[model samples]
Target: MRAAGLEPLEPYPGSGSPWCCRHEACGREVTPRLGNISSARQGGCRYCAGKAPIPPDEAQALMRAADLEPLEPYATSMTPWRCRCTTCGSEVSPTLMKVRTGGGCRFCASHGFDLTAPARVYVMQHHQHNAVKIGIGGTAGRNERVNHHRRSGWVLARDWHFATGVEAHAVEQAVLRHLHEAGHGPYLNRDVMPNGWTETFGADLVTPATLAAIGTALLSSLPVTLYCSGSSAGR
Candidate 1:
C-alpha cells in the first residue's frame, strides 16, 4: 500500500475507478463492501447497514414498524423494499427513510436494523476547534494520505478523531484530554504479535478496529511527552 494510497492509475476495471466508500458524505460513490453516498438502490446502505430490501416474507412485519398499510400494488411486499433494494422503489415511506439524528432507529426496529444516534460534543484544544485541517490518515493507504493532510492546520468534529484512522490510532485528543486532566493516560499498545493483526483483520472490515489495534501497538513502543506543566487543574 502506498503511504498516501493516492496514485495515478491506468483505467482498469475495479482499480481504475476512484474507490468512494463514504455513505453520509456528498459526491461519494459506492464500492463492493465499503458502501458509500449513492442511490438508495445500491448493494448496501451506509446508514442502515445491509437492511434494505429485506426478504418479501418479512416485508409485512417491517411495514408495521412505520404503521404503513398493506403494500400497494406499487409497494414492496416485504420490508426494506424486499430486494437488496428495488430500483427507485420509493415503496418505503419517508418515515422509513427518515434518519433520526441519534439512536432513534425505532423506525426499523421490527426489521432488526439500528440507526446511529445524534452526534455528541467534545472539548478540544484551540487548534482542534479552530484548526484548518479536517481529515484522518494512519494506514499505508488512506491512513498515510490523512497523516500528510495534518501537516496543514485543520479542525474537525471530535468523533472524527477516532474513526478517521489518520494517525494510525483512534486516540481522540479530546478524549485523551479528558483522561489526562484526571491524571490518567490511556493505554497505547505497542507489543502486539503479528498474529494480533491477522486476527484483527478478520473482523476489521469496519476499519476502525484494524487501525485501533495497530495504533495502540505502535503507541506502546513510543515514549510519552508530557505537556502539562501549568498548575494542576484539579479534577
Candidate 2:
C-alpha cells in the first residue's frame, strides 16, 4: 500500500475488507480493498485518479468556457450537470468529464442530420436484386443520399421534399412500419449493400407506386406544418 502512495492507518485487514488509508499525494483519507489494489483493478486514491470531487468554481469555469450555464450545483464528475446551452438556448445535462474531454451540448452538435432543417424522403429500386429502399436525407446535401444509391445501381423511383428532416423521417418510418406489418422486411444483407441493406426490401413485396402512395398517405396525416412539396418520379 505504501508503494502505491497510500499509508495504512490501521492493521492489515483481509484483502477483501476495506482498508482505511491516507493518500500520500493528496492527503485525503480513502477506503480501498487490498484485493483491488493488488490485482490492479483500481487506483489507491480516487483523487489521484481524477474521480474525486472537483472544486465547484473550477467546474463552473470549465462549463462556462464550453458555452454552458450550470443550473445546479456541481456534483460528481461522471454525473450529469444540468446546464443551459448558451449557443442554442436549449437546456441539456452533460457530464463534466465528457465536457472536459471535448464533448459539448448535444443540441449544438452537428454530428448527424439536422432534423429541423429541410429534407427529402426518397424511394429507390434496385432492378438486378428486385429490391426497393425507402429513406430520408437533408436537402442541404442536394440529393446526395439518393444519388449515392443511384451510383450503386439503385435507381431513384420517387422523392418528396419536406419542410424539415424530422417530417420526412417520420413519413419514412411510417412507411417502413407499414411494410413490416405487411410481412415485408429487409431483402438485402450487409454484403449486398453495407450501409443501406436495412432499408431495402424485395420489390415484389412493395412496388414503387405503392411505396409512393404510403409516403403520401403518411404525409397527409401529419400537421399542415409538416406538409411536403411537389414530388418527382423516375430520377
Top-lDDT structure, candidate number: 2
Predicted model with the maximum TM-score: 2
The true-versus-predicted C-alpha distance at residue 22 of model 1, in Å, is 34
Residue 26 accuracy (lDDT) in model 2: 75
lDDT of 2 by residue, 1-235 (tens): 9988999999999999999999998798999999999999999998666777778998899899999999999987766699999999988777887787777886687765576888888887889999888998877746677777878998777788788876776677778778888888788997889776877888887888888888878776765254444445434
Clashing pairs in 2: none
Could you report the Cα RMSD, in angstroms, for every candidate shown? 20.3, 10.6
How do the residues 11-86 of candidate 1 rate in per-residue lDDT, one tens digit apiece? 3235334443434432223343212213323343332443344443454444444344434422432112222113
Candidate 1: clashing residue pairs, number: 23
Provide TM-scores for the models.
0.16, 0.52
Clashes of 2: 0
Error of 2 at 103 (Å): 14
Model 1 ranges off by over 4 Å: 1-136, 142-152, 155-170, 173-235
